[model samples]
Target chain A: MNDTIGITALVPPELMYACGKRPLDVNNVVPVSSSSPSNKLCAWTAIWRDMILNGGLDIDSLVVVAGGDCHNALVDGQKAELSGMPTHYFFYPFDGDTDYLRSQLEKLVRFLGGIQDERMFSLISDLKAKGRALDELRVNDRARGSDVFSALISFSDLAGNPDIFGKTLDSVPRTDIRYSSRVALIGVPPIYPDFHETAEGFGLHVVYDELPYEFLRLGGSSLDSLASSYRDYSFAGPLKNRVRLIQDELLRRRVDGVIHYTQYACHHTLEDEIFRQHLDYPILTVQGDLPRPSTEQLKLRLEAFAEMLGVMS
Target chain B: MNIGLDVGSTTAKIVHVEEREVIFSKVVPSHHWTELIDDGQDDRCIVSTGYFRKKVPHCAAITEITAASLGARYHNPETQVIIDIGGQDTKVIDLRSNTFVINDKCSAGTGAFLELAAHYFDIPVGSLGRLHSLATKGAQLNNTCGVFAISEMISQLVSGYSMEEVIYGLHQAFALKISQMVPSADTVMLIGGTVRNTGIIDAINNVLDSKIEVPGAPQLVNALGAALYRERLDDGR
Candidate 1:
């Protein structure tokens, strides 16, 4: 169970994943919404602005947490530094090593206690089961249809609670839509939900999302197996490894094209040339600002990319 | 005759081709593309591209990136790169690989940025060429957004900087933004309505320190590419 935290710790809900409870999220301070010119991301800016306008924030400990890779994480750190908050910055080592990852997990475990609780084991089991259930839907040979879309949108929503997640997945509505091309989206998770809608509108069904959010993908049988899975997972460290993972999946899933979503001011999005160079398939890099839906430009590009990939008009 | 219409945000361009030869081409103030279409002319198979691409009904719709590459290939089969700096957006195409990189959601890297900056300087748009020819040093301007850039230019003007120095700086800034996107490359074939500005062309040439060619009828390249797409599809048929 200690291995579970060691594996999935770097991506999101960062260091506190070992605590076996939801971490404090500053993101909930306000709902991210739209603005003109589209690049002035309204996420944290609005929260701080609103708080100041409403006469100062009433908080004790504000800690910015990130997996310590890419600019979004750096931005979180910068925001913390600017706010003078106690922040946790976890720098991911370039060389993929279990020892490096486990050190952070150990520090976190000591800080928060609960090193070996039976609940953690049960949690892992339940999570693994839920993860398997989500993967099963990816195949969609069983008429799970549009529930797949809702299921994807809600994967993070229902990940922690295993009890009703299965029941909820069963009850969601399903509608089958024709997809002309199969696509994979990498880089930053979209700023707007309509990002997904736009791709579907362009007749490109997104089969693989490389963002760490939606599938925990705790792929292994035992604790050691889980750690091995993490060791093999390339998204953790080097660019070459991440590209390898994406390239393998592209061939395995038979993807037609790739739509990479990159946020402005983010490092990962800026250095998309590596991904483009490594991936043998056609790639369209979509750079957008936060709090805005898929723009007309992106839609036009998507339509063009889809057409270029031979999607039937 | 195959008609290709590039419907941009502020202007519309049309290219008429017959038997793979461009017979007629023109750009007009574009409120509507159908206005450019000759009355009762349905014999021409129309193709559309650019900003208002969806508004124009056509048999085939190509993206500016695809159209640029197709048009560049038609011009130079050995074409390696095409940089299009238009009013709406700037796109850098790696024609050899058929890959494209568009700038972030900002007008900073486009000709519109220069135009906006030029407007703030109160230099008549047509006189920019003569002004550029007379200017020597480019004053460093840091603001990337056109809106903020105007304020920055105002500050420079108040700070005892010559207007020519500032205007030269603005042109260099425009070229620098594009150079950042292209990073390193050989001679870049330039296209778009923005390329007609000789002042900007000189600035880009100085900044890049490399050869830049403006293919004849630069603005109509996309429209011709749209027509070429129809030509390819027709050939395939």
Candidate 2:
């Protein structure tokens, strides 16, 4: 029997599985969710918060990634805790202090009733390796970007079960991808549900999804290794480090352009200027306010971006 | 001859190009967009752009941003940035980086904002430029929001500012709102029908440090771009 644990942001799925718990990423449901949260700054946190409070999400306990990643979750997570949901606060060290992250992982393990199955670590490590292969398929144009993005974004919680998630990864259709330009999507994921598909419609092949790639990139066989790997989680640490990581990925991926998707009022929206200055690529910065189908306004930007990269280049 | 059709939020424009030169161009209300193409033209020879780019007859449809880029570059090969102030939205395209920002969420910096002010004054929107020239000193209207700025405009009217001065202030406010989206550039090309308003050009000049240049028949740039794109396709460039 596994307890379903809800996570507001990237909490180690391996640790949750090791603790005989299933980690469910709450933000995963947000893009497809129809929840219209009143009195909200960032819709991502607010919608998930409202869903947890309104009994929309089924979870035995909640873990809020408070220290690094999503500042709004700090307050929203407490709101859920105040409403009688058993919750734990997990922090990622902003300075990449492995010792501090190791301590935080220990606290998280205790919150999850301690690791009950140690073999779960290797299972997740293998799954992440598969995720990396799926990512490579798209980068090499052997797989459609939209199909690959749908699978890659789910790496956060591996769709709640590693075995089921592995099958899901296996089920992703492998087909040759054709596009006008290969682009990397940075910043937080777009709130629009059909964003990748829409980009594909406009002849832009999304080679990299930033945050989702982070999930597949960082993993380990044990708590000590996990601490070292996850501590360097780019979003958790300094901007310079994240920028350097993104630059390397962009180069490795050979992306023709970069699209930075910022959610309305998300703190990450502030990083757009820094990325534009540092990335040295043609960067298209787009913003989304609410979770809905991709708008004509967004499509215009994507189409224009494709044209700029394709026709102009 | 190649035809370029641009049907936007407020108006539809068409341009006829022959031998890389625009021979004729016309603008009409968006709903009457058919009038621009009613001269028995082949659909295969036409390229369409803007809001109704896909909804209209065309051989190839492109976004306004792309159209503006191609059009501005055709006019001035050294064009760095393009500030296209249309009826409903304003787009700032930087040709150097191939990046652009569109202000559609707010009406403050758009042509609709100016139209709202003109409606409040009970005057024709075209007369705003002439009226703006008459003001000696403009009043201050600081609100960035189009709705809130109207209230501020009324307050200025009540505070002894003349109608022309209030219009000047409104233009200044609009310029300030749009200036935020325009990146630092050596030369900025102003396009779209809204550039016909000299008041806006003056106000934008006052607010931005960059040298502003408006092409002849600024409104037809998108239409011309659409036509030019057709030529590009024919030449396979």
Measured by TM-score, the strongest candidate is: 2
The weakest ten consecutive residues by lDDT in model 1 chain A span A1-10
Name the candidate that leads on lDDT: 2
Mind listing the fnat for each candidate? Answer: 0.36, 0.64
lDDT of 2 by residue, B115-227 (tens): 99999999999999999999998999984799999999999999999999999999999999999999999999999999999999999999999989999999999999998
Q: Which stretches of candidate 2 lie over 4 Å from their true place?
A: none
Cα displacement (angstroms), candidate 2, residue A249, comes to: 0.4
Give the per-residue lDDT digits (tens) of candidate 1, residues B1-237: 788899976679998888889998888878866678867877667888887776787887778877887787778766677888878688887755546777646788776776776677666666666676777776788746766777887888888878887887777777877887774567688888888778778878887755678888888899988888887777763
* Candidate 1 TM-score versus the reference: 0.77
What DockQ number belongs to candidate 2?
0.77
Model 1 global lDDT (CA atoms, 0 to 1): 0.64
